[model samples]
Target: MSKRILILTTIISLVFGLAFSGIIFAADDSYWQDHKEVLDELQSDGKPPTVIPVELIPQEDEATTALRERLNEIIDEYAPRIIEMSDWLYHNPESGYYEYNSSKMLGGELEKQGFEVTYGVEGLDEGYNSVIEERFDAAGLPTAVIAKYKGKTEHPVICFVFEADALRAPTREKGAFHGCQHNMQGPTAVGAAVSFAKLLEEKNIPGSVWAVLTPAEEIPPPDKSAMAKAGVFDGVDIAFFSHGFGPTSKRNEAGLGNCCYLIDAALYDFHGKTAHGSRAWKGADSLDAARLFLTAIDMLREHSEPEFRMMSAITKTGNAPNVVDDYVQIDHWNRNTDPAGQAALQHKAEQIDQIARGVAMAAFNEVDIRHYAYYYNGIEYGWLNALMWEYVHEYGDPEAISEELGKPSGWAECGYPSVNFPGIHVKPAIAGTPEVAGHSDENADLTISEKGHRALVQTAKIEGAMALRLVLDPKLLATVKEEQARWQEYGLEKGLITEDMIRK
Candidate 1:
């Protein structure tokens, strides 16, 4: 009986030891290799892998471990450089559709890194796309440049756009500073792209990375829709972009909005008679026509949604105030909560424009309205947002990003509806601050704080990681294709929209 008991004990101990050994094995390459199929299936479900991550594998990849260790090192090493770029941009602020120096410098940085640059792509029939500035020394207009790094495979083309074109600088000289922290985003994007290329060159990453420096995200015009029209993203397997926030929170809210306004802009020219001083009666008042047009638009606003936004900048006014101005140019933009609402607003704006033309005719001779740009809002990529949420939580403080801003931080989600979209579920914003971690303040302070550089570094690593995964992780890549296909179908089912609709 004692021998039988001892034998049973030995058997139980051996079984327990074997189970532990299996777990250990799972932590190595075997774990990922073995569970690859399971993970592929789970991709459709859109959940994180239930299987445990492989252990010791990270240590095995010396390059990956080095990258993870000094991931922030690059951002830190280059953060000051990013700050220099941002500070320069902040001091020399520019408005939408006219950012010359900013674009040049931002794109030029990539050139220094041996990236094949494309300054002006055809199809954009506009002046230029300076989302944050109107300062122009650029070679061409309506330009969206790309820094290309060709790799082993064309199938895994990952594109990243720095929508850092903005007029911000929350605490600095306020007109058009890096207030939106776009300055940070653009340079950081460049750094990330550069780093990605470096990795491929040094190591053996199979995919390619295209660092796209896009303009006109901050101040999207209602009529101009270059991004949507360019079809630059047609062949992209994965895309990564980033935005700024106050330093109060660390994590980005895993929020999703099914719909969003792209960009639309319209300019109407009211032509009248320009008379000499004291010859007011001789000249019909075009200013009155412009005023009438303005009034008509104001009236239309009352019928629009509370969440909707309407703004106008007098792009071109008369050369002189005393002269009975012969021409008055009005530039207007609209941002609606959803596609239907945006279309409705645009229809209403057109009606108002006609009324304005009639009023201009009453006050002047002729009225001309030109569709400056058309932006059609489209679907946000669920996979991308899901990926972002996964990354944001892993790296960021949940409390920081999960909160909402009150009063006047000026983040209106009505148009950029990704906030409430169902694809990437999000928690409500619980709190906000003007301190570190908040969107505006934190962005402003990132230059001086380690936290800020960390944020930038983390974003870069995740982007690079995703880029790496696109080629290395075949199972993950299939899931991405599934999501992208679904999104494309959904965008199609909804009426096709142009940049004009995108603005509102």
Candidate 2:
């Protein structure tokens, strides 16, 4: 009987140990098992897929032919200036928020082209304007530029967003370069705006063109969504935007199928009385409280949602080894895809604070917690995506361009930019292979290559055509506006349109 009891106790202990060690066994019956042979045949052949160029001929109508001819002529006329702008931006890169020269330069060029200019329109801190006037002679806020060309009254407002921030990665001369291809943004947007403005003037097209130079898209202290809520896009009818994605040209057809994860970060500080290491029992140990707090957080992963992610770094942990640590600071962050998931993660974070407090109380210490950053995911517009694709095929030769650029495919794919507006994010190919993945020095260099220049010209043409098309067809604008209304209603239900996201 005793032996049987011992055996049961051992089994229970083993089970508990495995659970604590994050070892779990689950049954697997995947559908892939039965289709391995067929799936294997579809595996990669170590080469990019061939892209067949789909050159769409405009509809055989006088209006369509005229629009196409005008688009072509505008591209031919502005090609040199556009390429020069891109080259200049490539040589001179600037980081986010501090894009003073970039903004001034781009804004000056827009003003030269007869667009009404507005400068220094971005400030984010609470009471920043009021406080700065009292403390300092001037308010030093980040700079952004807005250029407008009013064609005719009562027409659709087509806005183009130009991001003028470079990446601060390791490769550049001073760890600040246009690695994210933001250098391409200015040329393409300016080219499109200039062409569209000319078309409207020459043909009396009834529409307005507004080109916006937003500061710090790469790392936004004030991101695009914040800019929108701050009235940057107040009277904008629709926005035209694009990004670089490798050497292939793609469009977000289904809008942002999967949006960027919402992230929030906070700092927690724990305080205790210091004492000698030998006489540690006489004083409270803040490090002890921090340890238990982090342990609880690690244990939380087992029960948290699958999409949740959390990480922490111990920035401060006392002064000397001989004395008991009195103060400790922890910086932690959490991320999730949706609002509910983000809320859940936030709750967990709060619970961690409580845990810290509880542990501190037991150790006769105290803790202070403060949250610093919270980034919400932007909303997507699907209806606008379809319209953008029409313009892409109308103006682009995906296959021929892909072959010449040595890209894998000419087909346009989808993407999600964290901005709350109805705009199409197109990725036109630059020259050469993607040496580095995502945002790297290699990608930055490609932005200045000859192929990159061609990409700038083509993208401008595509955007120019799209902007013109929207003005010509008011029905499309009405449909998009309807879709946007429905989306806003849905977003309200999902907690996307919170009080903080709206302007007073």
Computed on alpha carbons, the lDDT of every model, listed in order, comes to: 0.52, 0.61
lDDT of 2 by residue, 1-504 (tens): 124323433443333223322332121111122333443353234111121112221233579558857877987798898888877877888777677788888888899999999985555444433333332232333467889998865346778887888887675557687778888888788888878888888887677889988766665233454455557776666787766546555543221123345666666788998999999988888888788778888888887877888888898887788899899888777776554453465676687677777877877788877664455544454444444555555555555233232211101111112333456565554435445766777787776777777778878877776666656654444434433333334444455444344333
Task: Provide backbone clash counts, one per model.
Answer: 63, 3
**Shift in Å, residue 270, candidate 1:** 0.8
Poorly placed runs, candidate 1 (over 4 Å): 1-105, 126-139, 142-144, 163-176, 220-228, 231-234, 245-264, 276-282, 298-315, 319-323, 337-340, 373-376, 393-443, 491-504
TM-score: model 2 vs. ground truth: 0.70
* Per-model TM-score on C-alpha atoms: 0.67, 0.70
Worst 10 residues of 1 by lDDT: 405-414
Give per-residue CA lDDT, model 1, range 335-439, as digits (tens): 555544445656756775777678887895587766544444434443444444444555566666643322110012222222111122111111232454433
